[model samples]
Target: MAWIHLLIASIFEVVFALGTNATDGFTKFWPSVVTLVAAAAGVYFLSLALRTLDVSVGYTIWTGVGSVGTVTLGTIIFDEELNAGKVLAFVLIIGGVLGLKLADRKSGTTQPAEPEPAPVSV
Candidate 1:
């Protein structure tokens, strides 16, 4: 599904981003190479997902997933920071994503619903 493809692309994006940070101003050869490979895969899969999903929705989903994943990974893996404010902000981001999914489901946006009756001819 498009969501799966988008999430896969997000993982690649996070990998590429982390690799880029490890490149040290492009002076590091191996890290740069990894960055390139991961970036290529990220773009390829993102494009594939766009084939079925609207660009706006696909882009937001991809960005949201990648951003959250990267930030969480940084904080947990590297112990960057996980203060109360930052944690609350992350919570808000998660809440926003949940709201989007729930709204889409409740609205039945995936498939058109029954049309309303035509106005009276009188």
Candidate 2:
């Protein structure tokens, strides 16, 4: 399913992000290689999701997943600051993503276009 691809893409986005950080400006060989591979995989999966999902909705959700995952991982692995505001923002982002999903399901991907007006008299 498209959702599965999106999920994988999002996870890979996190992997590549962390791998890039670990690469030390690509000076490290193995980590840099891993980072590049992860980046490619992420894009590939994202492309799969985009085949059926709306671009705006799919891309936003993808970025949201990657962002939330990256930040959470940063807190756990890199010991980044985990503050109240950051937590609240993360929750809001998740809520927005969920809302978008529900809306897409109810309304479908593309909205109906308005009918063209009749030609005016000269």
Candidate 3:
């Protein structure tokens, strides 16, 4: 469930990034609205996912996936360059995200135990 939320958030992150580019510094009304909405949605979903997933793991994956999506879409939509270096970076980012997921799975989702109250004075 958390993973699903994270995935949704990541998609929104991509949309937010692409939409920001189209906004032209918020000069365009519709694009700016879309960008702001996407940004809000991405953060909201990310917060939901963070309830279960560790901040370190969840945030990293969100940004990593978002970056890859943005670049991939940017290339197609904006005609941005897609050189070997960028491709290599994407591969590395993806590999790191996968590694984090695997590690999280192995560790399992166990919240820390709450500390007990100290004994009352006599």
Best by TM-score: 3
Question: After best superposition, candidate 1 residue 118: deviation in angstroms?
Answer: 37
lDDT minimum window of 10 residues, candidate 3: 107-116
C-alpha lDDT of candidate 2 relative to the true structure: 0.90
Question: Which structure among the candidates has the greatest lDDT?
Answer: 3
lDDT of each: 0.79, 0.90, 0.94
Clashes of 1: 0
Tens digits of per-residue lDDT, candidate 2, 18-63, equal 9989999999999999999999999999988888788888889999
What are the RMSDs of all candidates, in order?
Answer: 8.8, 8.1, 5.0
TM-score of each: 0.78, 0.87, 0.89
Better of 1 and 2 by lDDT: 2
Rank order by lDDT, top first? Answer: 3, 2, 1
lDDT of 1 by residue, 1-122 (tens): 66688889999999887888889988999999999999999989998877766565667677777778888888866678778987887788778767765665576544433488999997
